[model samples]
Target chain A: VPGDSLSYPEDLCPPDNFNMVSTWIYRSSFPKKKNFSFLKKLGLKSILTLILEDYPDQNMKFLKENNVTLFQFGIAGNKEPFVQIPDDKISAALAVLLDRRNHPILIHCNKGKHRTGCLIGCLRKLQQWSHTSIFDEYRRFSHPKSRSMDQQFIELFDGREAWKVIDPKWI
Target chain B: VPGDSLSYPEDLCPPDNFNMVSTWIYRSSFPKKKNFSFLKKLGLKSILTLILEDYPDQNMKFLKENNVTLFQFGIAGNKEPFVQIPDDKISAALAVLLDRRNHPILIHCNKGKHRTGCLIGCLRKLQQWSHTSIFDEYRRFSHPKSRSMDQQFIELFDGREAWKVIDPKWI
Candidate 1:
C-alpha cells in the first residue's frame, strides 16, 4: 500500500528515517521541539543521543520537561577518518538501553547517520547480523558518505562482553 | 539530508518500507524474486514470513536455492475483524526470532501491514514501548487501512510470558 505516490508530513525535524526495533526501541535523526512533541505524543521514555558536539540547552530543558531522559554519547566527526567511536561508550549506552523500562527509546545523532549508523551496526552484531546486511542499512542512511572505519568497527564488534551483562530478553 | 526529496531504488518488491531494526533484523513487505536477489545481495540469511496465505512454489524454491531459511506464520486475513491473529502463533514466531542465528532476518506480510503490524505491536509491548509509538509505527505501514483490532491487540498484548522465556541478548 505504501507506493511511491504518497506524501509525508512536512514538519522540519520530523523524526527522520524513524523505524522501530522490536517495538520498544526506535532509530531516527535528532529531534527538534516539534519532533520532541511528536515523540511525547508517541510516549517516548528516553533518548540515546550520539551527537559528538552541540547540545542545545533548550532541547535539554524541553526533554526534562517532557520527562524524557537523555543518554548522550558524544563522538566527534561522523566522517573524519580518524574519529573512531569508542567501544566503552557504546557498551555504556547499551547498558542504559538494556532496561526494559527504557522501552520506546530513541537512538539518534545529528543527521541520524554516521554515529547512529555505527551504534546500530554494533547492535546488529549483538543480534548476530551479517556484515552485508549491516553495511546495507548503514548505506541506506549515509549513502555516498558512509565511512569505512565505522563499517570495520561493526564488522569486528565483539558482543560477548555486552551479552554477559545485558538482559537476555531483548533477543 | 534524508528529506522527502530523495528517491529510493527502482527494483520491484525491494523491501518496501525497508529498514534496519537492529542491524540484523529488517522490516518490509513481501518480496518477489527480484527483491529476493536484492535481499541476497544484502546477505539476508532468513525470512520470517507473516503472510496468511499464498506461498508460491517459485519463491520457496528460490529461497531454498539461495540458502535463506524461511519461517512462515500464516494468519488468515489482514483487515477482517473475524480473522484474529493467534497469541500462541505470535509467541512461536517470536521464539524463532529470538535466536541470534536468525539475524539478517526479514519480517513481512503481503502489504507489510495488519498482521505484521500486530506482531510488531506485541514486540513493542515486550520492549515496554508506549502505545502511542507502537501505533504510530503501525500506521506508517498500514496507512488508510490500519485496523482497530490490530491496534487493540497491541495495546493489550501481555509480554510477560514471552519475556520470561526469550533471550535478552537481542536488545
Candidate 2:
C-alpha cells in the first residue's frame, strides 16, 4: 500500500486546528462525524478532552468501537479576570500525557485554541522549551483569538507537580 | 533521561516557526548555531533543505559530527508574478521524504514558510487530506504572509510523479 499512486479518491478532513503536538500526541478541535474516518487512521489509544460538558454519545460510541480510553480533564475556558483553568486539572492532564501507555493521544477542546494551547504550552515547558518558543507555538494554533491570559497561565504553570506523577519510562 | 524531574535548567530554543510535519519529518526556519542543541534532541538522520544557497559551515560541522546526511533541493522562492518553485524539485524532495532511511529528517528553508508550506501541502495530498485541512495548516505556519501562489502550486502539483520514485516501505 505504500508505493501505490497518490490518486486515492478518499479525502480526509481533520478537525479544525489539528496538528501533532509531538510524538504520539495530537491536538485539535472536537471531532465531528466527518472527522471520525480521519481519526481512525491515527489509531488513537486515548483522547484527553478539556471540555466541561458530558461526552457526546456518538464520540463515546466511536471510542468504544475503537477501544480508545477517555481522559476528561475538564476545565472552563479562561475568560480573563473571573474564570481561570484550574492548575490542578492541567497537572492531572499532564500526568496522563506523560504516561506512554495512554499515548497516540489527542487533546481537544471546542475550538482547539485557548484551552488546548495552554495545555500544550505547559507540555512544552515540561519538554524544556524556552518561554519565547512556547508562546510562539501557542500563538500559532490560537491565531487571532490568542489570549494574553492563556499565555500568562502557561508562564505561571509549574512543571514540578506534573513531574511527581509522571511514569519514568515515558518521559 | 526519561522522567527525570521536569526541572531541567537548559531551555531548548527551537528555530522560529519550527514544528513536526509528521512522525519523523520536521519543518523549521534555517537553523542557527543556537538551535543546534535543540535539533540534537531530534536525533535527525538527515536534513532536507529547500534554500537556494550554500549550507552554512556551522551547520555542516554539526551534521558531520552527528553523522547526519544533508539533502539539498535548492529552489528559488515562490515570489508572485514571476519566480516559481519548480515542480520537479518538490517531487525530488518528496522522494527524499518518502524514504524512511532519510527520516527523522528536518526540512527547512530561510523562513520555513512558503517553500516548506507548499512542500508539506503536497505531502498532505499524498496522505489524502482535504484542501480545507491542508490550507488551514499552511496558513497556521505562514500566518501574516501566506501566499496564494504557493497554495496554488501545491494544488496543482501532481503526486503520481512522486509515487514512481518512492521506496514502498517508507510511505
Best by lDDT: 2
Task: Write candidate 2's Cα lDDT for A21-56 as tens digits.
Answer: 899999999999999999999999999999999999
- For model 1, residues B1-171, the per-residue Cα lDDT tens digits are 111111233422345556545457677777766566557755778889887676799888978888888898888754464666777788777766756888778888877777777887776665445567677667756766788878887776666656555666653
lDDT of 1 by residue, A1-171 (tens): 111111233322336656655457787877766566457655778888987666798788877787888888887754556566677888777766666778778888877778888887777666444566567667766655788877887776666655555665653
lDDT of 1 at A83: 68
Kindly list the per-residue Cα lDDT of model 2 for residues B1-171, writing each as its tens digit. Answer: 443635566789999999998999999999999899999999999999998889989999999999999999999888878898888888889989978889899999999999999999999988889989999999999989999998899889877877776667766
Q: Measured by C-alpha RMSD in angstroms, how accurate is candidate 2?
A: 1.5
Q: What is the TM-score (0 to 1) of candidate 1?
A: 0.53
Off by over 4 Å in 2: A1-5, B1-8
Q: Tell me the TM-score of each prediction against the true structure.
A: 0.53, 0.96
